[model samples]
Target chain A: MERKTLDLWVGLFVVAGLAAVLVLAMKVGNLSTFNMSESYELKADFGNIGGLKARAPVKSAGVVVGRVTNISFDNASYRARVTMVVDKRYQFPKDTFAKILTAGLLGEQYIGLDPGGDEVNLKSGDNIAKTEPAMVLESLISKFMFDKAADGDAKK
Target chain B: MLERAITGIRGTGHRVVNGVWRLGYASRFFLAVLLHSSMSFRRFHLTIKEIYFSGVLSLIIILVSGLFVGMVLGLQGYETLQKYGSESALGTLVALSLVRELGPVLAALLFASRAGSAITAEIGLMKATEQISAMEMMAVDPIARVVAPRFWAGVISMPLLAAMFSATGVFGGYLIGVVLIGVDEGQFWSQMQAAVDFRQDVMNGVIKSCVFGVAITAIALFEGYDAPPTAEGVSHATTRTVVTSALAVLALDFILTAFMFRGL
Candidate 1:
């Protein structure tokens, strides 16, 4: 092939490859779209996070409207403080409830937001007071076993 | 018996010394290639041609292998994940495996076996035929004129080939996961989107493929250039190029993965 034609093909190949990566990052990875729009931060405190990570999705009624931007432990309250960056387009009521939820029976954890019947809208820097911690299956199983043993002892 | 034992120890020591010497020589040659390759823009045509030979020609094998691997992953993942009642995560499993690990490593292995070996054979043949020497006689720098362009071409083409491989692999996974296995198509894709991250998974894979490119291409060129100028020497160098590049890619993959995915 002629040099110019060859160069054109190589350039085309590079562009195509980049496009593929872009698609993978956006469609499959859910990366580029998150940062494109304006977002506002809201903080929620949980007793336990249980694999809840930064960058985990924050969904409202099963639709992702934000991401967990930061996760830190509050020394005073002894709670897992999760800072979420919600897209400005999606507004929630001030009384919205945030709970940590797993994708599958034992999959990735995310924040599930349930909107409440409140006239006030949640603004940036608002603290979401009502938060449910992630359910630890191990702890639940242990608790169940302990309850069973205690019931047997009481019957005896 | 005593003399034989002494000779054996000496032989082993000599081999180790020779290996180190060869490593130093190859490093110097690679440095020269890198230096000359900065001027490669001036010889963009040669670089393009090399890329066509190395990257374009290798695409068929990469795509086919990627597709087959993805199909296998989908099949296996569906079977395993179904037992857990989480068959919907087939997309997440396949996409993550391909993008994070298989895409870069497998593409590089194929590239090494295909383009890397070809580069070695071609350059080794040039040396065997005294073509490089002739260029040297004409006051032309063979490393700059011949090796640098091919080196740059291989490096440039590697990451692109890997990305293409991963893309095709994802499609192949979709074919099996969504079409054949009766998986929810939306769940397959959406689950992957929710699971994968740009910096952690995708960018790390790209970084790995880029490093593999440099290492594989360097090994191929160094083997060819340093080969003894004979037909047998050329053949040996070609074989060594494949074997060495494969080992290098795997070892580098392990080290890179450990560092990149350290906290996770």
Candidate 2:
């Protein structure tokens, strides 16, 4: 091959390679979903977080507005302390309720935020007071069984 | 009988010693290539030519294989996920598998057979034909002039090829999942984007490819340089290049994956 032709082909190969990486990052990976805007942190305590992991989506009104950044255990409170980074564009009320919710029957878990009617908005570093723990299947099934046994006794 | 048993033990010891000696020599060669790499950088066109030979020429096979792999994943994933009525996650299955494991591993395997064997054969032939000795007789260092460019080129081309493989594979999955089978296109892309994290998954894959590149090229170069100067020896060196590179890539992949994706 001619020197010029070789150079052209090499240049094209490099270009294509770089373009592939760019596509992987922007389209296939989560690079495009990242919120580059200013964000603030909020903490919520739950009795059980279940499988809610860091980087899990934090959604309000079925739209993802933040991500779980930290999940830790609070020794004094005996609860799970979950920290989330929320976009500044969406502000929640002081009484917003945070709950652990699963997407599908067997899917990953995430945090769901339900806004409350309050005069003041929650600020950065504020703790959300109202929170719901993840629904544990074992406990739910046991409760159902207990209720069924109680109903049978009452009928007798 | 006792004399024969002693001979067998002697043979085994000789082979073991020879293998260890060769490993030490390969390590030395690796260091020499790194030291002599300045020439490859100073004359960038030399490295570019090698990239054209190794990277550009390997594009067709890499792309076609990626597509086929992705399509197969799409079909199989759909079949299994449909049982749970979660077929929308076909994209997640295909993208994660390709990006995390298959892309770098399969691409390196193919590269080892294609470009790596070719490099070993070429260098072995050069040594057999006295070309390396001729360069040395002319007071030119053969390692710098002949070996460094190809070494750097392999290192540079590897990650690019793997990325191309993964990107192509994802498209193939999309074609089968969304275009042919009529899955929701929005769900396909959104699910993939949500599941495949840029820093955790994509970057780690890139790191894996780069490591594979270094290992394959070093093995190829060392095999060629150490081969005996004969046609049979050169052919054996080429074969060894492919086999050793493949084993090295797999073993290194396990170690890297353990360190990278563990406890996550």
Candidate 3:
């Protein structure tokens, strides 16, 4: 084969290969959407995280605004301290409520930020005070059974 | 009967010793290739020619196999996931499988059969024809001139080929799930993007391909160089290249997956 033709073919192959990687990263994977912009950190404590993991999406009104950066046990407070990085573009008030919410009947848990009526906007390193823990299925079922038993007693 | 049993034990011992000796020799050859790799870069066209031969020529098989694999995953995943009424996860299943496991492993297996055997055969033939001896006599370093370019080309081509395979497979899944079946197109793509993290899944796969590339090319080159200068020897070496490369790819994949995906 001619040297020029070989060079051209090799060039095309390299280009195509790179383009494929680009497509995998941008379209097929979350490289285009996740953590691309600058972000601020906020901490919240939950009584029980219940399978919540780092890098889980933090959403506001069903739109992802950040990602969970770290999850650690607070020995002193006896709670799970979850730190999250929210995109600088989105800000919440000081009294925002953070809840560990599941997507479906069986799905990954995420932190849902419900903005509250407060004059002060949250800044980096700020801790949101109002937070709700993930609802454990066992606990919910036991509570329902207990309530039913009490109702039966009252009727008797 | 006692004599025959002793002979069997002796034979096994000799074979084990010979295998270890060959492994040591291969390691040295690997080092030599790395040490002499500057020539492949300095004379860039040589490597480019090899890239054309190995990478461009192998495109057809890679693409067709990738598409078929992806389509199969889509069908199978949909069948299983729909049992739980979560058919929207078809995209995630296909993408994750392709990006994390099937793409790199399958591409390397195919590359071992297609380009690897060819490399071994070519080099073994050159040795059989006394071309390597002639080059050595003329003060030309055959390792630098011949082996390095092919090695670098394989290494460079492998990751790219794997990426192309994965991307093609994703497209194939999209064709089946959304275009053929009545899947929601938005859910298909969105689920994939949500699940397939670039750094964790895609980059680890790229790293795996690179490792496979090195292993396949090195084994091919070593087997060819070590083969007896005869037609039968060259043919045997070519066969060894395919079998050994396949085994190496699978073993390395298990090790790499354990390291990369253990936490996830």
Q: For model 2, state the Cα shift of residue B237 in Å.
A: 1.1
Clashes of each: 0, 0, 0
TM-score for chain A in each prediction = 0.85, 0.90, 0.94
Q: Taking the tens digit of each residue's C-alpha lDDT, what string does model 1 give over B142-225?
A: 998899999999999999899889988998999998998789998998889877888788989999999999999999999999
Candidates arranged by DockQ, highest first: 3, 2, 1
* Highest DockQ against the true fold, candidate: 3
Q: lDDT scores for all predictions?
A: 0.90, 0.93, 0.93
Q: What's the DockQ of model 1?
A: 0.63
TM-score of each model, in listed order: 0.89, 0.93, 0.95
The residue ranges of model 3 lying beyond 4 angstroms of the native Cα positions read: A119-126
Candidate 1 TM-score over all chains jointly: 0.89
Return the TM-score for candidate 2, rounded to 2 decimals: 0.93
Please give the lDDT score at residue A84 for candidate 2.
93
Model 2 per-residue lDDT tens digits across residues A17-59: 9898898999999788776357999999999998899888899
Give me the runs in candidate 2 sitting further than 4 Å from their true place.
Answer: A35-43, A69-78, A87-94, A117-128
